[model samples]
Target: MPRPPRGAILAVLAAAQFTVMLATSIVNVALPQIRAGVGLSDSATTWVVNAYGLAFGALLLAGGRAADLLGRRRVLLAGLGVFGSASAAAALAASPGVLIAVRAVQGAGAAAVAPAALALALGLHPPGPARSRALAVWGAVSGAGGAAGVVLGGVLTRAWGWPWIFHAVAIGSFAVLTATAACVPAAARTERARFDLIGTAVSALALTALVWGVASARRAGWTDPAVLAAFAAAAVLVVAFLRIERSAAVPLVPPRLFAAREVAVGNLLTALFGSVWIALFFFLPLYQQQVLGEDPLTTGLGQLPLAAANMLGASLAPALVRRVGSRTALLAALLTEATGMLWLSRIGAHGSFFTDVLGPSALVGLGLSVAFVQLTGLSVAAVTGPDAGLAGGLVNTTRQVGGAVGLAVLATVAGTVTSHAAGHQPPLEALTAGYRTAFALGAAILAGTAALAALLVRRTPADGPAHAPAPQPAASGRP
Candidate 1:
């Protein structure tokens, strides 16, 4: 088949990426309804969401390797098939256990596709305006798709039912998969290399244990044996993974990726943003439902201020960077986001979304969208050829891991505060205390991201030193 136009390829890839990410936050808009229908306990409700995160975060590096060893198109197609089918199953699920199980499968499929699809976009477009534009679009779609998902989820849940959101995904997956097969040109297939199967397995096990343990501690107690064991196992698995990477002929993730200044900071920021974003999405909806007594659709609508601003900021951010250095832009965006979060720390249940949440939400959206592009540019700047897979994977891994950690920490803080306040106060007041604690922590997180961005990112820019001018068509390596 003739090579598809880069434009066409990007549009398809962006839609695919957008749809995958959209699924992440879309469910939040319908969580209340889903919980009621599935008869989930308040404490157990988190697993419904976190299950997807655990699987996606655990398998990312291996997914990148799969893309490299197998083929980006092949991996992407397989992932789409899995994700779409899982969505269907989830929609039809009769119990919380079934829904959670299917969501996990969906997340696994997403892990397989996201990095490979991103790598394909980078590889298809050469470095320059074209590549930048593609990345910018990628950033925009990231926010836009998520925003669309919120509206879609609310609309589907209110109008049709929560299950329709997944049903829509089922249809979307089929269409995107067909277009992907027909449109994405096959690249020159690389010579297959051995993959670190042990490393992959250990890494997966370690992260799952660590995340589940930390997340569980809010209810299970800090001294819980399960928590202690999880941390210990994660540490051991991490060490094992490092050893395997050091010795393996072809590792899933090269050790050197951690050393790159831009890559490192970029990953850190991605994680930070993911954590805060997920926390906001999760907690805000709870506030709306439990404290404000709003329906799912109304709650989703309340988020539009942030969503629309994110889209606008994403469209303009590339130009902003060409003027201000990426480091400066990133810091500015972080500070702005922090300010918004700080303001949110004072938000009461009685306040309106437009007055109390609108300003902060818009700033958060801007922060999310702008910082995302800078992170992408930095991640991809030094990357050329197929290393895009690993680079994309690293950025994504940071986001997923950060999301999981952020959610755990926030939940812990919220639970502690809410528990304390519950003994003496009305439910709304107690919930407000929990929200304040969580939002305050969110502010600290953004501030930390700003400081890190300033220190690690170079003022005088270079994609930095090249690992290689161009890569050989060898398998299982990063950009």
Candidate 2:
């Protein structure tokens, strides 16, 4: 088969990426509809989102390794099949249990797709300016995809129904699948490499337990027996995973990968950025809906400025890195992010969108986009070509896990603060206080991230030193 042009390949990959990411937050606006339709309680409804996140975050490492061993193209195709099927099933689901189950399946498929898509794009574009340009496009799509998910969800839900959102995803996934098979080249597999089943099991179980514990704690309280049990189980399983990696001949995650200063620092920063980002998405919609009396569609429209700003930030990142150096750029962005979060913390029950939300959101979006692209370059800098997929998986895994954990913790804080303030203030005022507290905490997190980046990230090539390593051709099952 003749290879497609590089641009065409990237377009397909970006579309697939967008679809996968869209699934993460698209349902936010439709949550109320889903609950009413399925007769789900508030606790059960939250699971509709958490189920997907838990599966996606837990299985990502295994997914990344699968791509490297089974082949990126092959894994991507399989992922699309699973994702499309699951989306169709979700659209048809009538029961709360069924919807949650299928959403988890969708997440598993997404885990498979994301790292493979990234690795494929990286493989196609050589390092330096070419890779940076490609990454800029990819980063922009990712940022826009998350925002689009929320907007599209609201539009489709209002116009048609909540189920239509899933239907759209299914159609989009199928379209991308067709394009991928035709345009993307098949990469060679690692013939001798073995899957680390034990490592995979422990890591997945550990993450699931941790995320479940935190998410459940919001309703169940921190002292709940179930939550305590889950946390303990997670700790034990994490230790087991580390031990398994130490002994496994072909570890799912090579322990040595974390030794690189750039990789380590980059992942930490990703986690911090991801934490605030997820929280922002969760709370801002609530602010617009419950506090400002905006409908779902209006709330979605209100986010356009942030999405546009995110694109602008991605487009400007490469230049910023060139002008200021990766370390300095990252530090500045982190500080900027912190400032935006602080600004947003001033939200009030009577506030207008332009005055209270727009400027701060755009600032946060810009800072996050710049940080995302720079971090992507830093995170993968240490890995050999053979492990690029693994590196991608690790970076994404941290962000997802961090976001999940942070959301749970932040939600608990907000809930507690709101409950306390309700005794002394009006309901809307209490709610605003809760959100402000969470945003303030988020700002502190970015400040700490900036300090870490300043101290740890080197003042060198954002993509790493030119002589760090050479590309090793991946094997194809066929000679």
Predictions in order: lDDT = 0.79, 0.85
lDDT of 1: 0.79
How far residue 39's Cα lies from its native spot in candidate 2, in Å, is 1.3
Question: Candidate 1 regions off by >4 Å?
Answer: 256-259, 461-479
**For all candidates, what are the clash counts?**
2, 3
For model 2, what is the alpha-carbon lDDT of residue 154? 86
My TM-score estimates for the predictions, one after another, are 0.93, 0.96
Tens digit of lDDT per residue, candidate 1, span 1-479?
Answer: 67777789889999889988788888887877888878888865777778888888888877877886778888899999999999999889988789889999998999988998898887766655556567778888887777777778888999988889899988898889999989986655557777778888988898888777777775687789988888888899889888888888877787655555666656766788778876877777777777777777887787788788888887777666666656777778788878888888888868777677778888888887887777777766665455567777778887888877888789888889999999998888998889989989999998988887778777733331111122322333332
Residue by residue across 1-479, what tens digits does model 2's lDDT show?
67778999999998988898788889998999989988889888999999999899998888888887778888899999999999999999999999999999999999999988888887776666667677788778888888888899889999999999899999999999999988887755446588898898899999899988888887898999999999999999988988888899999988767777677877887888788888888998888898988888988888788889888988988787766666777788788878999999999889989889999999988988888787887787666566777777888898998898888888899989999999999999999999999999999999998888777776665544221232432433421
Top candidate by lDDT: 2
Model 1 clashing-pair count: 2
